[model samples]
Target: MGRPCALREKEVERVFSTPTIQQINSDYAEFFNLVGNNTGVDLSENGFRDITTVVDFLYIQVSYRIYYPPLPDWTTEGNVKCNNNPIIPCKDKTVYEIMKEMNDLRFYVMYNSTELHKLDGGSVLTDIGKKFGEYVAGNRSVTYNIYSAHDSTVSAVLTALQISDAKQPEYTATVMVELHKSAGDAQGHEVKVFYKPITDNSSIEEKNLPGCPSPCKLEDFLQYVKRFEISDWDKECGNNVPTTPAPPSTDSLGLTHQEKITIIACSTVVVVFCLILLIMFVRKRSSRSMAPYLSLGTGA
Candidate 1:
């Protein structure tokens, strides 16, 4: 994070040398850069320390407004703190406008970012597909399936299905998938999915699961959902190199088989030559010592 321009460079390196802190610093810096470039604002003063302060404050404001409408203006609210200053004026923008802008930014980051959507959303999609598969296969006896997930979770699922139009789901938005059976239909079972809005209860936003008919057959629904199912989530998550252990090397410190063979042959030949020389020396020494005894005996 380049010492944050506030702390001593050496101290920052010493205190935040750990990988977790480094990652946090890295993410904070990226966010500051992205926001600063996009909004032309100075976030350097509170880059890592208070980057999310305003957003958090907005969430609180929005929360309070749920029960009590007409809360204080978010753009000119005293709740936001940056550089320890409150009530910063952001010309002529209101709470609703700021909220919408934030949502759009979030949608762009979580859904429109293709690689990120795939990497982050892939596992969630796979899990849901497996859950549905169990129900279709008659293994699960449950009458209903309910998924409680975050906005990003729902958007990621949609992104993985290649049906995301990259818009923020409104507050308390939900996507519901229902499975049913009927006697009149040729297919044994059928499926219908709806996007229910929080703003209006009467809206029934029925959307097709790409390449499938509305209220598709249970078999077709199963097959269509399986398209997003991954065999292994970890394999497709990213370019993580597999950590398989390699087999033991046989060559012994990089000596080839031919080199070992030549060395062994040379050693064997040297040993055999030494044995022959030793035998000849023993026979000659015995003969030399016996010559003196033979001469003494012959002197008689």
Candidate 2:
């Protein structure tokens, strides 16, 4: 597997919590809406008041499919066929079609929510591409840069790389990045990048970096990857902004009760500080004047 490339925490993972059923429903409802906006799935079906209702219905439908395990392309989303279901009359709502909506909903949730780049609507790609460049440049000395992360991490990285063609990654699915250097001819040396989806098969020829021919040259790949590297990542990220608070509100001349109290307290401190400073300034001036007279031998 390629090194786990993580720059920002997945926003979905942060927002998706399992604290309570209400919280889960609320989160899922928002997620469904976001997905619906993209997929144009009519989530308001069958007496559904809100997106939460659709989510609840989906859960129930999924549960029913799991329990009965419907028959002959009639039961589940992936296997179900609308026309030739021998067991039940569900041409209108054959399994996969309904499931595909849910699937599409889920896909759009991950697809839209994730950040693209810290530089420009992107973040993970910036880091991942830089890391790939580093690896290709023979800079990293570590054995394994591990990514003990969620499915969102995998999805986010893929989306950032502009590579996510398939559905979300399965559990423990590894995306291997193979950077190979060839010594076919004495005239020139070449390097290519290959990405393999999580699979048991040994063959990785199908997952070639698109547009670039297989066994692509090193210089060419470097030039291609350089686009993802931002000129100033820190500036682009806005990381150096100080945490200094906004100045107190000055909307009204007459202060409210709380504001009155705050202003009074502040005025007291300001007066005290100014008085102390004035006293010091006067004493310093007096001392300077006194010094000249004292130098005249205490007025003879």
Candidate 3:
């Protein structure tokens, strides 16, 4: 006798007809249609159905594989898959790995091109629609308002901006945001963004200078939809004008020659002091042992 099939035709049909499954399928179809229409990509209903099924399966498989423990309880002698493998398991996985996995899954499906995979036009319609909406009204423009943060944040921001690929140390994301407005009404609109990292005490001092304003607060960014304001041609807004300061002989923090010399001298003194103490301790111990041996020889 052959083994029975896991799902019969009627049973499969019944599962698909369930309310939860039906709602998910409807949502998936709508998402596919939206992306395809917005990006001007063509996709068929069958293709959409197939892609949806594949994505759903991948999500389930990955989630289960990554989170399911070999042993559910100590009482059970044999190793077995988790009975209720939740999408997110708090005890089994680290928060960072979970976040990374989620991000990878999202980016992969969201950015996959239909042409490359011979997917129907509807495959990337949802993502394209999201991108379009974001480009038009979202805060895609970089903001330089963070003045204090971890180095990882700085590295991430730099990566996003196509700056240096160097990994920053912790707490280096402190940066200032500068916004530049468009030149004239005829030119439509444009904004220039600038970010400066604040790493040391000197950077903090520069931030507290007389004229330079602090980075806009998070609340300010949230409240103000537009970070840049239109420059009035009549009044001097100083948007286009370059305000150059006198060139310093040293670095921007104005560290004078004397200050540099003093710092170097202090460092040398501290090092020499430690060396002298170490030598004195060693010599004193050596001299005591030699004197005792000399006395013993004379007595003998």
Candidate 4:
């Protein structure tokens, strides 16, 4: 299943919860009504009343028969069929638009603020910049640096660069940062950003960071992205709880084997002395009772 809405902001969490199936039906009643009219199936009155069922339905709409071995002849959004009829006949555009909204909302929740952008994408961009700087300085040999990341990373980087189209990143979405230099150019090396969406026919698309040229100069790109760079991630993310010092090791308690033996011997001696005193007290009381009995016998 796709990730649930990323309600990261306190206000967003406070204001929203998972929408019930009934709520979804109510909110998107018009879209559902159109689907029902076109397909002769009232989703609201059917098993779609449960949210899990609706989510499964949406999943089926987007990903149909793409996973199993011996994949279908063709698997695309166009192949989404209801009763063996193409979904396009049932207002597929509306369905897709709703899906897009779901993705846009999720992106907004995780990458809305500048700080969030830094926490999610700033460090990554910083590392790329530093590595590229190393390569330019002739200190690095590796040419390709690959990072496998989640959709949130893609969304965050796009948002940080102010180039996000506000669409939900599809599965296997990728963002690439490349360094380039023109032959003996006065401007020296430059940086370029490219993104590839998850669509079957999707190709890498060049993206320009806001206020920067298409092929942004390395120096200017570094300067622009510096605002998002973070030196201390823990401090920046407010994860600054003082660490609890580890407990002292038991072996470091400074007790020698001989000292331990001496202490145990002293404790045993004290216990034995107290036992002897208790025995004497008990014998004295017994003797006193016996003497009184002997005196009564003599009197008798």
Candidate 5:
């Protein structure tokens, strides 16, 4: 591991000029830390691991709601509207105008489910143990099966692994698998798997760890991440992703010649004012020094 660098306040300010981006990045790190703490898992340990491979997936679940009319009327008008806009339409009736709405509903369900999964997955003890094993294996340069995923992803992995307890509430768990090898022992290898419950406010707290590598604020992290994502997209999509041009500035706002002249004149006036003040300050100090000398000469 490289030596950690400490960033001063001014350095942080210089790196992250924009407040919003700084806030977002801070929040993101905080969220990650919180998840780690709640689960009693230290993801930072994994940070030290030589991460050779990364796999990502989503876990999914379906929910249902019963459709009922206001007056319990099953007549054609009521039935048509109900069929057309049922509170919860059947899988087949979800078509045409309702398709967009259904898609939106499904998206929301997936998002919420994923969030819940992350929360639960973070706190599970079994998951943390498996993660630690993976970390050890990675550090030892062993070809180990390691997995890190969100809640939905965990559920899906568990289901795929044919783990019996893969249901909600009772079977909720953070699924993990790992392989490890002993240092300097080519043939010494170990494989492990486990699951744990998701909990809130889980995180591993670090004391005396090296500070941030650079004087990076939240904005700096955002810009770094953004550039990374854009570069990745460019590599993946080739020519499909068009490069965006920089936006026009104040100079490109179609200002008239006279307005431009006025702005320049105003800036010149401010500069002149500052120079005048500086000159006056120098003169005042000179006069004050001379006053004492003149008084001493007259008294003598």
Candidate 6:
């Protein structure tokens, strides 16, 4: 973790140096530059180390307001006035207006500027599609499946689904998929999607998936999501996994059958020759010992 950035520059460059992010970063810097020019005070004086600092601060406010409404409001903590600061762009704007603008900007930065949702959101879409498939086949017994995911997850899914009004999902926002079976003359299954915003828990907004009917048929829904479904995530993300080679087979030990037979014959011949030499040595020892015994008997 303490490694130098220079060493891992190539690995992380794609994230920071993408053309879309670069353009957004440029725009971000220009906004800060205008603020600095008019205020006669460097906003960077307050630990604004990078161009993303101001945008990140605004996002933090938005996030806190939605995610933790019970918490004390940080924006009004220091008697801060919207109109007193000429550098502040959202002068005389309500908190809701500020959040809305930031949310829109966040959505643009995350999805609108690039085709990243196709890559990042593919897995979530695939899982949802599989669930629909399972529900139709009666394979899934559980009725409700919940995914505790980040806002990016919601945005990516919406973008991948080609929802025309796709924007950044607020904190505690939910995306639900409902599978309904026709009761009467209608014999086909239908899929319905609903999004519940954090602002109103009681209200669930029904969305019309682009290129599909309001109550999309199970078959059409599956086909529509097929484009965004990811089968091999690692391959799609360009993650290369090392593979081990299989062991060689015993039948073919890199030698011809004739060569193996010749080896066996040579080994047999060597074993038989060693056995013959051992027998001859044993006989020679026996003959010498018998001669000594006969000489002793003759001398007696």
User: In order, what lDDT does every prediction score?
Assistant: 0.55, 0.48, 0.37, 0.62, 0.35, 0.59
Off by over 4 Å in 4: 1-57, 64-97, 183-187, 246-300
What 10-residue stretch in candidate 2 is worst by lDDT? 44-53
Better of 1 and 2 by TM-score: 1
Per-candidate TM-score against the hidden true structure: 0.49, 0.42, 0.19, 0.56, 0.22, 0.57
Q: Choose 2 or 4, whichever is better by lDDT.
A: 4
Q: Across residues 107-149, which tens digit of lDDT does each residue of candidate 5 receive?
A: 2232232222222232232343444445554654544344444
Native-referenced Cα lDDT, model 4: 0.62
Candidate 6 matches the true fold with a TM-score of 0.57
Count steric clashes of candidate 5. 17
Residue 117 of model 1, lDDT score: 42
lDDT per residue, candidate 2, 119-218, as tens digits?
2224444444556667756786752444455555665555554566635454454554444545776544355434445455654433445466656665
Put down candidate 4 lDDT per residue, 139-161, tens digits, no spaces: 77799999888766878778878
True-structure lDDT of candidate 5: 0.35
Per-model C-alpha RMSD: 13.0, 15.3, 26.3, 10.6, 22.7, 8.7
Off by more than 4 A, model 3: 1-149, 169-172, 199-300
Per-residue lDDT tens digits of candidate 3, residues 1-300?
A: 011222222333443455643443444454335334544444334322234333333344443565553322221222222222243222354323332333333323222232211121121222222333344365576432223433333443333223322322223334333333335544233322243444444543223211223342322332232212223321322223456787647757788777889899999999999999999999999998888443445553
What's the best-to-worst order under lDDT?
4, 6, 1, 2, 3, 5
Error of 3 at 180 (Å): 2.7
Ranking by TM-score: 6, 4, 1, 2, 5, 3
Poorly placed runs, candidate 2 (over 4 Å): 1-97, 104-125, 128-140, 185-205, 230-300
Clashes of each: 0, 8, 15, 0, 17, 0
* 4 against 6, candidate with superior TM-score: 6
